[model samples]
Target: MRQITAILVGAGARGRFVYGEYAKKYPKELKIVAVAEPNEERRQLAAKDHGLSSNQLYESWEQVLDGAVMADVAVISTQDRMHCAPTIKALELGYDVLLEKPMSPLSEEVNTMANASRKYNRLLTVCHVLRYTPFWSKIKEIIVSGGIGQIVSIQLSENVGYYHMAHSFVRGNWNKAEETSPMILQKSCHDMDILSWLIDQRCTKVSSYGSLLHFRPENAPVGSTLRCTGGCVVERECPYSAVRIYEEDDPCNEWNRFITNKLTPEGIREAIEHGPFGRCVYRCDNNVVDHQVVNMEFESGSTASFTMSGFSHDISRTVQIMGTLGEIRGYMEKSEIVLFPFGGEAIEVPVTVEEGGHGGGDEGLMREFLKQVRNENSNDDQGLTSAEASLQSHLMAFAAERSRLEGGKSVTIAEMMELQFTQVKGVASPNKVT
Candidate 1:
């Protein structure tokens, strides 16, 4: 296989750990030729790891795009709101893009990116990495093969663990809807995408209900301060305590790396004492919902209901797909899938859990993307990662959020899509067609 040269647009957690690491693992198949990251430390580390010289390092995405096109693909893992301009620019600059999800918080921007991809005739694949995992992919395979007959309904629950909720939604980058996006779009778009992909149908209608029910000020303990480092009385006892979760050595082996980049005890303590992760979960200025439920009706008369909550002890997705011939129940945390025929004994499918992030989805997605870039994969119709294909889930999420905010009113995908097109036409230049 020819080495596919790539550009790294954001060197943060996802960019470095998930996508950039792919080049390190399979250097003969892919090569990272350039990078653009604002953070000096992360930029330097990524550049050094990818063997990029000073001339290849850029301080901003704009600089990378403004210069000559340097590589075959651009890996864009910027923040939620920052996905639009860079992706559109990269496509316009003749680079295939691997963009991070939530595409953008706004439907108009999502449409714009999709339009840009089509207009430029460049591949724009979003990082809906869940579709690439063995666990989910096997389910999709079974559904496609008619193993489960026709998918009648799907019930999926994304149980965002307590400490993870505190770390991410309550205290981290996606705390506020105004700042990033609604909890549904920010966190559960993967579930929405999965639901649509499994059903193999476009969503027709959606209704949702949820809110910031538990993490508000009234839910705070009686003597709790705004920050966990402020000598709160219940700091040691509270399970959601920042100091307890971030400062101490994690009992859970999988979570130790997430607590602090500095592996030392002193480094962890210092991060807790100074960083945003140390803030009291209940006292933070978080406005996004802590729980939500969405009901979806598909074009083929199939239905799905997705539940996203931040209070589970385990941080994983559990799905139940009911069909005419058999049923599939999967727990992502356990990496197990159970099949039940209407009349026979249950069959357990052995799932080999991949050894990296997102149950090996991170690697799987990169593998397929490299194949496509190298002209080895041609199944474009089933390409779940493409921007045009991924937009449906974002529209579903937008409609779900609209329904949640509007008292669980049923919102049609047609309405959302029409609104998206109308907005796109309103903002389009004279030479651009709607």
Candidate 2:
């Protein structure tokens, strides 16, 4: 095996903690050679971790890719909308890309990215890390091996968890749809991608129903202060209180530091009193839905149902795949799976969870990407979450969002594919579904 050099495009949490940690743990397999981050703190932090020289650090990805193809691959963990430009430029400049998911919120940008990948003949892989997890991999193996026969339907529940919803959707970087993406795309596209992969079929049609039911000004509690750190009458009882959740409990955690990199109690107090994360969850300007349900029809005539909610007690996922011969059910938090055959006994399987984020999927994805880049693995590997595969999932999310705004009207993927993404008053513009 050969060592593959990589450029870090964003030194945010995922880039620094997940991918950068991988390089640190296995320097022989992968090495981080350069970094391009807009923030001085994160950029310098990356440089320190990777031992990068001044010449190897750039303030933006444009500068990193402008001079030369500095590394074998560019790892793009930029903000949601920023994924397209750097990815396309890297491919054009003779570099493969490991891009973060929800490639783009716009259909046109997604299409342009796919075109760039094929035109440049570059290896483009989306970080659909869920597919690489031991839990999901076991499920895929069973379906491929015909352990449960032909796949008839799949049901997935994405429990976003209550505090997570408050931290991310209500007050975090993804607070507003216009700033980032709709909740479905930013948060649940993984679920959409997983469903398409497990069913091994294209989603033909999609319809969804959801809205910002609980996280809006209209839903704010009476007499509540604008910020949780304020002397609100209900501070002690509010579940989304910044005082309790951020400063008191996980003061030094990533989510708290995300609001302000200070990570100290005083800095957190100051941040909550003035910054976004400190605002009352229900009094904020969040427009994304707090809960949603999507129904999809696949090319094979099978159906799949997915639901995402912000009220779960734990941040986890549950799946049940119904097949012609039997059914397979699994809970991700437990890492336990059960197989039940027709008129047969139930069998339980134990999954060995590796020590990494996303149930070891993060590490698994990096491993596979390195193998592919080194020509040790096939680019056409059935498990590769390439740009084309992730494109379908993105389109599925767009169709679902269009359906949500149109009163759950059925929207076909073909219609979404045909129309260019435009924002004339709102997205899914012209309402042209022909």
Candidate 3:
């Protein structure tokens, strides 16, 4: 296999650990020759792991672009606000781009990137990794094979685990919608994308309702302090206790490993003492909803209801599809799928879970990106999570947020797209996601 060169835009969690590890594991398939990260620690870590020289490291994405086009593709995993700029530049520089999810928090930027990819005739693959997972892939296969008949309704629930909500949404990088994207866009766009893809139709209308119900100042225990370690009498009693979650210094702890690179006791304590993750979950600056429900109607007359809640014990997604002749139910965490055909015996389908993040979706995504860049066979079983498909999902998310803010008023996809275009072209457009 001919190795392809890649440039890393961000060396943070998803960048350094997930995609960067792919290069480390399969050096012949991908060689990360350069990296651009503002964070010193992450930059250093990525440098050492990728065996990149100091000159190959840059402080910012702009700095990376200032240098010669160094890679065949640019793996842009920067945060939501930082996605569009680097990705647009990378495409302009004749590099295939693998962008992180939610493309951009702003709808205009999302449209701009989509148009830019087409304008340049470059492959712009969004990180809609779920499309690449065996679990979802199997579901897609069943639906396509007529095993489930015509998809009429889909019920998908993203049970964002209690620990995860408190750690990432409530305290970590994505606490506030203003700083990041809305909870639906940042946390649940995968659902929107999958719903559209599985049904293979445009979302015509969407209405949603949600709020920051449980995590707030008034919701905090009567005696809770601003920080978790601030001598709150109920520290041990709180399920979201920073003490309980970060007390251990074990590096192997799944949650611990993601929070800090330094897994020592002193490191953990230092983080808890001053870091954002150490803040009281109920007293933090988080403004995103703790629970939400979205209703979608597709052009094919199929419907989907998505519920995302932070109260669940496990971080997983469960989906049930109702069809004319059969129904399909899947649990991503279990990697299990059951087909219940009307008047027929239910069958369990086997799934092969590859080793990596997001239930092996990360590896699946990287493999597809590498294949596309290598000009490998195009006629295959791979689903195209291309720029247009990604844009459709993003519109769904943006419309859902709009409907939520408008008191659950149904928004049309046409209006949403028009609104998106108006803003993009200095005029108003209208549509909603259903």
Candidate 4:
């Protein structure tokens, strides 16, 4: 295989995971030639960790792409809204791209990335890493193998788990709808994409209903203001206390503790006190819905309902598929599947668990992407999610958000493409449509 040089943009949480878990495991197929991050501390860390020279660490996407056009690929792990600029730039610069999901904040930007891939003859793949996960893959195989014959509908619910949701949305970048589009687009775009891929049908209509029912000052117990973990008398009783869990656990709390020494107790304290995670989970300025439900109609007459909630005990997903002949229910966290035949008894299927980021999907995706880019070829054997597939998933998310805002009106994929994203309509519009 040819050596594929890759430049990774962004050095945030997810970006670091991609580098450490995925790229670190596949040095032969991929090489980190450069990294672009505005934060000096992070850029230096990436350089030191990857053994790259100072010159290879750029301050922005433009600098990286300008100097590294010869780089075989670009891995975009930037902020949600910033995905379009680097992805479009990389494609135009003759580099294949592995873009992180949700493609971009707006449909038009996603469409632009699609156009650029075609126009530049660049191979662009979206980082819908869940598609590569073993459990999800098994579920897909079961459906494809007719375990649930003539699948009619699917119901998937994500346990967005209160503390996790509080950490991400209530205290993080996705606090408000306007701040980060809707919760659907920001978080569950992957879920929407997974459904589309599993059903093998076009999403024809989408209707949704949701609101910020919790995680507000109104929901806070009396006399308990911001910083529940810091000052609340009930910190020991509250499950969401950062002090009790994170501080007590020290190096054990998987979510709070950092692998590097830089993420010290002082850093955690400072972040929570002033940063997104530090605020009282119940007193933040969050506006995104704590719970949302989406009703979808497919072109092939199949239908599904998707629910996302910020309050749940589990962190994984559960799927129930109802079909003409039988039904399949997948418990993702436990890696167990139940198949209920229409007239016969139910059987349990066991699946293996692999240790790595994103249920072992991250490493697989990196391996496949590097293989394709190194060979400069595309094949079914690789099965990487293409730019088009990613856009379809993102568009479905857009439609779902529209449905939520407009009283659950059905939104067709065609309508979204034609009405919102077919043409250049935004300030950062790509005028030259490919």
Task: Give me the candidate number with maximum TM-score.
Answer: 3
Q: Write the per-residue lDDT of candidate 4 for residues 86-152, one digit (tens) a residue.
A: 8988888888888887687777778788888888877888878778888888888888998778879
lDDT-superior candidate, 3 or 4: 3
- Please give the range of 10 consecutive residues that has the lowest summed lDDT in model 4: 425-434
**What TM-score would each prediction reach against the true structure?**
0.94, 0.93, 0.95, 0.91
Model 2: CA > 4 A from native: 250-254, 376-383, 420-434
* Candidate 3 runs further than 4 Å off: 249-253, 376-383, 428-434
Best model per lDDT: 3
Residue range 162-236, candidate 2, lDDT tens digits: 888998998887878887889999999899999998999989999999988888777777768888867688888
- Candidate 3 overall lDDT versus native: 0.87
The TM-score between candidate 3 and the true structure equals 0.95
Clash count in backbone of candidate 4: 4
Model 1: weakest 10-residue lDDT segment is 425-434
Off by over 4 Å in 4: 68-70, 250-252, 257-261, 378-383, 421-434
**All candidates' lDDT scores?**
0.85, 0.86, 0.87, 0.77
Clashes of each: 0, 0, 21, 4
| lDDT per residue as tens, model 1, 1-434 | 89999999888878888788889998998899988999887888887898888988989999999968889999999889899999999988989889988898888889899889878877888888899899998888778888789999999999998988888898888898877888999899889888988898899999999989999898899888878888899888899877667656565433435556676778777777787778888888999999999999999899999999999987899999999999999998788999898898898988878977778888888888877777733335325678877889999998998888889999999988877877777853311111
